[model samples]
Target: MDIVLGLQWGDEGKGKFIDLISENYDITARFNGGANAGHSIERNGKRITLKMIPSGIFMKEVQNVIGTGTVLDPVSFKKEILNLQLFDHTIQPEKNIIISKKAHLVMPTHKLLDIFMEENPEYTTIGTTKNGIAQAYSNKILRQNLRVGDIWSPDFQSRAQHILYRDYKMLEDGGMIVLPALEEISKEFFDAVDFLKKFTCTETEIYLNNALSKGKRILAEGSQATMLDIDHGTYPYVTSSSTTAAGACSGLGISPKKMGEIYGIAKAYCTRVGNGAFPTELLDEFGDDLRMKGNEFGSNTGRPRRIGWLDLPALKYAVMINGVTQLVLTKADVLNGVKSVAVCTHYELEDGSLETVSGTLSENIRPVLKWMNGWSADFVNMKSGSELPEELKEFLSFLEAALEIPVTYLSTGPGREQILKMK
Candidate 1:
């Protein structure tokens, strides 16, 4: 089994790559995250934004699975399944898509808890998506949550009610002013769970292990990115679950030794959603132009991503942490027609020290940039490898030299055919 995930922040154009190469794998499984993730893919002029389902759904030969490590929100997942059903009448979601029985279900109270916790003055506000991801993971760690398989149990209602009441009682003490009656909210929650129960769910460990034993090609795709990992990322601003390579093991119940090539996806320019320390942020006119041309907006929250120059130091940090085997650069064409392109090589510390790797750029540190002449090209019109732009090729070469990882794939546009494989 191989792994493909974002090397930068969340939206690094991973969905396009997943859709691009999905035919090579028989199975595509999402290890971490829930419906909060937005992976946009443009195929045949149709733009599809995948939230909970695997990006390989478009490929009829691929089997998509949502793994155990994810905290699933039943409402969002059910909606995605319904949409897929409408899009393709032949898509038997029960046969093609698999849901892990061990995957924790997102409770309605978890969503409320996330809102209250992130908005509370007593705690740190990480500008979460308010999808109850943090709260759901909290419940999982505390051993007070329900899994997807719980829907089949006769005691499901009683167990869900107990958890709901517990969450309500905790929020009530926290000065919650307005809340619907517990009976009403709990019923809705149960209904959502019931909607999820219509799908086929099972223990994935045995199936995944059996697949590995049979040598079936599996592509384990991860949501979020290494920079958003809770343990290794910029803390207090990172996501609740693991977004690194280590996540594939725990999240999928797969042995680390069973892993193959790890492909890391990164955009030519860096972009981050939500709030965090951004060292190479461009608050000028050029930043706005990148946003306009690249359409740099959050696929999920619709929030404008904080634009910045590509940070080599930051990218290098992600490459090291994820042990990225091969690198894929997305949205290279987005940098076309710009006056100049600057990459952050290092940072100047407040103590008069120079650091190549970024920990956190909290006001005291400033990025040291290396500027290059902006290479403009109409790569979208190009059809073959020989038609690749000269200046763009040189830029990729420079990026590869600095990061010490090969540039294997370069994406020219939004469409699947726009991607250029390195010769």
Candidate 2:
């Protein structure tokens, strides 16, 4: 299977790229993360935000699979399916979507735990979406969580109750005084679980393996990015799961030998949600302009993203780590009308030495920038790279040279048709 994922933070426009490319593959599978990672897609003039569902849901011919690594929130998953049906009556999720039975469920108690952790002063708040993602994963590792297949068991309610009360007790012991209405939460959770019974839940790993044996092609899509990987990303600030090409193996139950082309997506500039060290961050009006022009807001939280110039050093790190075969540049049109643009080519340390991504975890590392002329040409009507402005071409050329990867696609706008295939 081929792979596509974000090279930077979570919202590098993976949804748009995957949506546009899903038609070529027989299946599109999501490997990591959960409801916390939001992918926005604009198709047929309607914009929809997907959390648990794969971005390829809009494609009827493509089967979408939620792999084992994801934390499934039945409530939110139900809402996403209903929203899609509301937008297009012909889109049937029940027929097209597959859920791995081994996938862990994100219970109501997990959401409460998330809120408690974020609010607690003793712990560091990594600016989570409070979506219960981390808590659900924690429960999975602790072997105290319910899986999608567990709902089929005759004593499902009993098992669920035991875990719920256990979590409630733990929360109470952790200093929480007033608890929310347990009955109401339980009803909603079970109701959503009942709603979830309509879809297909099976051993996706075996199914995918059989499909591969039959010569079927799959596209593995990931949520979040390399820098947000739980193991490889910025510590304490990273997400709860892996977000790299290597993750696709364990997440989707595929072998490393089955891997194909890996596509890494990044924006023209940089924008990050939540709190983290961003060396190239712009705290001035120039940053505001990028935000306003790009409409840089968190898809999951709607919070204003921290904006910065493109950090090539970090991008290079992502490239090397993921072994990205091709690079997809997004939001290039956001830079339109600017007189000049800059990229952080290197990081300068306090010891008067230059570094690349090695200094990303170090404190007080200064970004060394390389400036270039910006483009103002309208890309709305442009169809190919030949129509691109000279300045923009120069920018792409520079990225190709610096990163040593081909720039294969450019997303000029939010619409599905706005992407230009650049080889």
Candidate 3:
């Protein structure tokens, strides 16, 4: 069974949940995103940040694959592998991990383009990680992209040179100033190409399908949240890929029939990393407290996140798109000290019309919240359903009542064993 999530924002504690459930699955695959993703997992009392690789790689018998839809950042990926090796020599990635040959390469030129685009003060900035995701995908769409398979080709150097020269010429034609020597860019490109050769696999799609055919369970992991989906999310400020469940099929080349058990991960409150429309965002002490308590920061960019009250309308919209069958709420422990909590039940438009929270409505409207009693007891050490505070239970019941989705898993802390299965 495949569990999919991202009910609220991107930092939905998916890594810990995926790791916990990974023991039941044979294969775990990350279908999208690049270094822009920061999936944090706590295992054996240690916190780990997973970027390119699936968070389930820590599982003993599970195999992890980076699907074709991902953009490979060789530098960041290599560092992560080395960091993991420091903890366990037995975790030889070459034996269990595979990278798709069809994945787009995040070249230095891509980074350059990302910076260039963000430098334009007149254009509304999307607050990207500047990791080059947009430019790399742009190259792919423009048909000038270099894939993992192309790295080992005999003509790889010549092709890279030609492409680099063309890109530089295009930049010059656009009246944009260029930096760094052409030769230097070419050298760095070849070096990155060589470094990525060891991780490339040509038949990721075929292998994933074969595993499914053999009745092996697979997990389709998404990086960002539904609100960041390029097509469905807030426009002009969203990510470059499809972060919804439909993306799982396109990203991993799998049939929709093969997917099962959609699980949406969200937080007790809401938070967003970049610039976009946020209806329930708190700009005062309440927001500051949530940020400090939750340690709300972008795992990928290290930027402080914008915190806010829970937005049920947005959560319902996300659940509808991903067909979330179960909900997992994380960082509930962070709300322990608050006396009261507010959840955005609906939106009030500029024209004073009430509407459900959505990309369009959220972008231009304000939120109307429903207040609830907050739980003050510590839940970090609680392992069973009976140990939960009554107020916490009431909060969960409120969420279920509002969204009409069952809350099955609740995470109180950042440890692997910190989750309480409620259903």
Clashes (backbone N, CA, C under 3 Å), per candidate, total: 0, 0, 0
Q: Give the per-residue lDDT of model 2 (tens digit) for 211-307.
A: 9999999999999998889987877788999899999989999998999999999999888888888888999998997898888998888999999
Query: Which scores higher on TM-score, 1 or 2?
Result: 2
Top TM-score model: 2
Best by lDDT: 2
Q: TM-score per candidate, in order?
A: 0.96, 0.98, 0.95
lDDT (Cα, tens digit) per residue for candidate 3, span 225-317: 898888888777888888988888888999888778899999998999888888889999878978987899888778999998988778889
Q: How well does model 3 score by local distance difference test?
A: 0.83
Can you tell me which runs of candidate 1 are displaced by over 4 Å?
179-181
**Worst lDDT 10-window in candidate 1:** 357-366
List pairs with backbone clashes in candidate 3. Answer: none
TM-score of 3: 0.95
